[model samples]
Target: MLRARVELRELARDWRSWCKAIAEAAEKTLGSSRVYVFGSAAEGYATGGSDVDVLVVAGRLPRSFRLRGEIKARIEEEAGLPLYHPFEIHLATWKEAEANPIYREAIEKGKIINAQGLDSMKPIGESFGESRGRLPDRSLGQR
Candidate 1:
């Protein structure tokens, strides 16, 4: 039983590492855009089977399934993770993130980690709005 518990803990650590790597990869793929971790991964309750939840604030991505697929492929390749890794990515313009209730709530509830330098990245979502990747000026509990 003790051995099983240890193994489980180790597996969880691996997933966290994978999540960090994937986040970095996403930043690289999106260039000046920001990649954020939320849900299980951000709160640090991730387990081996847990899905890595991510939010991407970027410029308009082509609305093509093939292009999205290629982007994911690039992330996997850059992160050195297997293609089948459990990564669930939510994409939006920074303006969309600020205006959407769901995104605002998630940002409030989830801790933002500076895996990539925020200053180094440009606000790619200016086409959507002027604000960078900042959430709307509100707390999670208010709404």
Candidate 2:
């Protein structure tokens, strides 16, 4: 979708540094090996204040670490302006990506990002399976 591309491009130009920072944290703490952008950000039609939805694939993480609040706060501080959209980072594993229908659909429709979790990304399908259509607009990561 156009919204997804525009929103992600805007983030790349503006919030990419912060996003990589978060990815570093994810890799270190969540055992993530890769990250990707999905949902509206991947669809290329996002407007102002569109939230970013990213996926992280890796081994399981410890329960103690949380990236959302801390990364968001730091990014907001560094930018000197609050992001119009919230950072929605999803944590999953390769097994989950394969086993979970929704995650699989996201991968199929998402755009891979070169970030801290991993510089290289694997290719995925383009069509969303009928049973696994687009998830909620609020947070693809959440589902």
Q: TM-scores of all models?
A: 0.61, 0.52
Q: What's model 1's TM-score?
A: 0.61
Residue 48 accuracy (lDDT) in model 2: 58
Residues 1-143 of candidate 1 have per-residue lDDT tens digits of 67655654554456546656766887788765556566776666777666666676665676777888788788779888753446676776656777888776556555443354434222233322435455533233211
- lDDT per residue (tens digit) for residues 1-143 in model 2: 78766755566545445456655555555443555677765676655567767776655443434644464345345434345445676766566676887677766667555442334333333222223343322233322
lDDT score, residue 94, model 1?
A: 59
* TM-score between candidate 2 and the true structure: 0.52
Query: lDDT score, residue 71, model 2?
Result: 45
Q: What lDDT does candidate 2 reach at residue 140?
A: 37
Provide the overall lDDT of each model, using Cα atoms, as 2-decimal numbers: 0.60, 0.54
> Judged by lDDT, which candidate is best?
1
